[model samples]
Target: MAEAASVTTTLYYYSIFTSPPDRSRTSSSSSVSVRRRNPSSLSWVLRCSTNTSFPWGCDTDSLENASALQKWLSKSGLPPQKMGIERVQVGERGLVALKNIRKGEKLLFVPPSLVISADSEWSCTEVGKVLKRNSVPDWPLLATYLISEASLMESSRWSSYISALPRQPYSLLYWTRSELDKYLVASQIRERAIERINDVAGTYNDLRLRIFSKYPHLFPLEVRLPAMDGNVALVPWADMLNHSCEVETFLDYDKSSQGVFYTTDKPYQPGEQVFISYGKKSNGELLLSYGFVPKEGTNPSDSVELSLSLNKSDKCYFEKSEALRKHGLSVSQQFPLQITGWPMELMAYAYLAVSPPDMRRNFEEMAAAASTRTTSTKDMRYPEVEEQALQFILDSCETSISKYTKFLQGIESLDLDVTSPKQINRISFLKQLAVDLCTSERRILFRTQYGKRPGPGSGRFTDGAEILRRSLRDMRNGELRALKILNGFRKLFK
Candidate 1:
């Protein structure tokens, strides 16, 4: 089996659209067995099954829609599958194993014609012409196309697929501004989500002013709204699968077959909800884009971004700012803190930010080198400089943690019974995500501050550094244990 790290990277490598295709193509002529459909429309029913070990709920309408879509895909040249759509506790609707499947089995073979890509030709030719001529980037263009097709409803070629889509996606884009402010005030994800929403609106406005407004007939007002949150592509039945940190399956276009295919990395049993990684996204990222968060401590790729800047009150602030500017870095810069630790660039920036006048001459060299190389907190020396830098990071992380803690406390005091269940769950996830991020970041800072060894200790002369290190270690372990306990308790409610 592929290691989880490499598998996560593979998922990303396949999902990105780097360039437009020259022409459309078709897949093999293989056929899959299709279940006979009832003439009567399936009722939109939400069934909660208590028999499953995990909480399982399904909408009959969605499953019916998925079944129709599968048949359409098969007729359109999709190869046979051993997987079928089912209700899943993790993602509402997901692809589940229909039978025992082996590793390296081909789960899906989506034809190029069915695969939505940047090069997809739009039904509205005039609008497509303008977009193509102007070279609108792939992501936004694809998003626009998806909305355009969706607006047509039953008339669309992808009507069944559209019907199968989640009516209420849990993405941050769906969160109200008030909700974002209340729950994600301290998270860096909130800023990114806001920026993305603004960008989508901006892109739509620009298109309207330049093209749609003039050719009103081609682009109707009903279809002019922005629908995309960020980079996304809709793959019919393939998208129904939820994300898993353990699975290595990934969707990618195969030039040889002229279709999109995903291979299973591990064996799966019948009735198991098979999953594909939506890349190794952080909990915040997963929530922002997909509307879900992995269990606490399970997401290995999780990280939190911290903003750092030199204090204006410092005597050498001007010098440091100038040095940072020379290296294409702003005085205020962001650094990512991962579970393992932080990058060398953070330490270099911290060192430069607090370096004295005598060390100022070396700033340019240090800044240049930092940008090109990878450094860790352990690798960073200069006790005086690093101490200040680590302290700044520690303080920032603590402040963020405090903000989340206050919000969580405020929510706990409120009458949550009055709120919608969905809203309650979203708030709960956001609070936990904030706590997890803060905990991971603090661990790194603690390690930086107290991980170093002290000289030998004598009787009645134990080194203060060793004592402090042991204390920090114990505290870190306790924090992790508390997080685990809290997570376990949360699961009980589910």
Candidate 2:
């Protein structure tokens, strides 16, 4: 959301992920044997079932473990200078400039020996071989690798790094189903979080059926099911760099240096915290993956999705639906709404939504523009249906805002389901994060419109942007940006 040059974490963005908290393993030099447990003991079957402290990993803010990781990396051939891990205001713990860092400086030359990828040697050779024999993907493979090494404790080379990882990573995947429904009931993010949770489950189920169930000796029942979270390739020192929406830098495999590195896009003074981008993510996306949200109005890239749907009873419903199908669109669609501008595809979809029977000829064109894959003209507009299209979007904006309002206003009265103090603390933390995310999402909707509740013929927007911009937050406190964009929308409407 912090609009700047963009990049992805090629050290690869590992979420605060999974595994069973309670388990015992005793290891020999050649292999680590895990004790078998019932399917009921598996944690991935219900990832966030526990609300209190999980015993799988150490505290996230453990500076002592962080200190040990630095020493281990130094001895393991990591060529690092200028930055060191330190407690920071932004991301709990992050890389801070040990000395003045130049804007274009290449930092953190983490060598291959120190890196963790799919090819990293497993503590148990047989376990690694079994996964590779099946050609398991990087995510699932690495997830299993983490839990395997973690179970070995001091016997595994990665003990310091694992100990530094938060026992409970602040991700939405760690939130229970009811927590999502209760706190985020009004937000579309609730649906996205549910889908992510299901994805982890589906991946686990697939692995269980195809691989784990076959090799109980290599991957005991508890280990296989609990070590199921995917989409991560852990890089020890490199991963210590916390995310900032403002920074445009990311870690990558530098071929010449034979290590992973991220070139700084902005200079840092000595003692200043260094930040890197975690891709261009929305407020909700950051929460879903990283379990943090940037403050409101700071992240320029933050946007809310506006859903537009076709009338079920419309006379042209079948024809419109068919046209949309050909263009890879559904009868209902969602378009992203940024504070600066909405997508051209949204404008086109809105035009399609309000088109009359006489204007049916334009259905395919509207649907085509709405599909991002379509190479055709993107800015086609109909002067006859212009006002109707703007009114339709205005109606959707107001409807979304009301839902956000209901949850935010009544948040204080929300009751907790937990009895213990620790569980209460966990739920309270999750609830506060939901409030931050929903508040940020709602602000974007408010930026677009404040017309009356949407209903048949929605006459509030009959006069168009004249009423629309006036209600789009009064723009008096030097909100010149909002006024500038509204003028563009006004011209588009006319």
Q: TM-score, each model?
A: 0.72, 0.80
- Across 342-405, the per-residue lDDT of candidate 1 in tens digits comes to 5557657777777777877777755653453323223444665644555565666566666656
Write candidate 2's Cα lDDT for 387-488 as tens digits.
Answer: 677778888887888888998998878874468897878778877888898888888888666433122121111123433444333433335777789999
Candidate 2: where is the Cα deviation over 4 Å? 1-55, 221-232, 416-419, 450-494
Off by more than 4 A, model 1: 1-61, 222-233, 369-380, 414-494
| Best candidate (score: lDDT) | 2
TM-score of predicted structure 1 = 0.72
How well does candidate 2 score on lDDT at residue 151?
A: 56
Q: Residue 14 lDDT in model 2? A: 26
Report the C-alpha displacement of residue 477, candidate 1, in angstroms: 23
